[model samples]
Target: MKRGDIIELIEDTTFYKKGKKAYFIGRSNFNPNKIEIVWVGEEQAYKDGDIDEFPARLFKQVEHGDR
Candidate 1:
């Protein structure tokens, strides 16, 4: 996906470790089912913990802004 694609997290629990869980980071340069992004900013947070990054596979591109 490009820089502005809205996405949601998919269930990629298998890829992550036991304690670490994948989360939905913001948009970045990515390829479908191959390349994904993980947000690494200090402000990043998921649930009650700090989520630095997540796999691009977790996200599904949202196409609402096009219309």
Candidate 2:
């Protein structure tokens, strides 16, 4: 979906494990089919600028107020 949407991993993919939640940043610059996301975590290991790109098919949009 569009940028700023929240998404959750539905399948265990190489980049992320199942159930991981992330913020949808945008599409990959190199590939339109790929999506960029910033995963949510309690640890500070994930820097503010850290972003990951994964296949769009692996994630599903999470609605607001969703658990």
Candidate lDDT (C-alpha), each: 0.42, 0.78
Q: Where is model 1 poorest over a 10-residue stretch in terms of lDDT?
A: 16-25
lDDT of 2 by residue, 1-67 (tens): 7766788999997656899998787899999899988787622534646678898998898855333
TM-score of 1: 0.33
List ranges where model 2 is wrong by over 4 Å: 42-47, 64-67
How far residue 7's Cα lies from its native spot in candidate 1, in Å, is 0.5
Model 1 over residues 32-65: C-alpha lDDT tens digits? 3443334323224433464334445555665432
Taking all chains together, each candidate's TM-score versus the true structure is 0.33, 0.75
Compare the candidates by lDDT and give the number of the best one: 2
Q: Which stretch of 10 consecutive residues in model 2 shows the poorest summed lDDT?
A: 41-50
lDDT of 1: 0.42
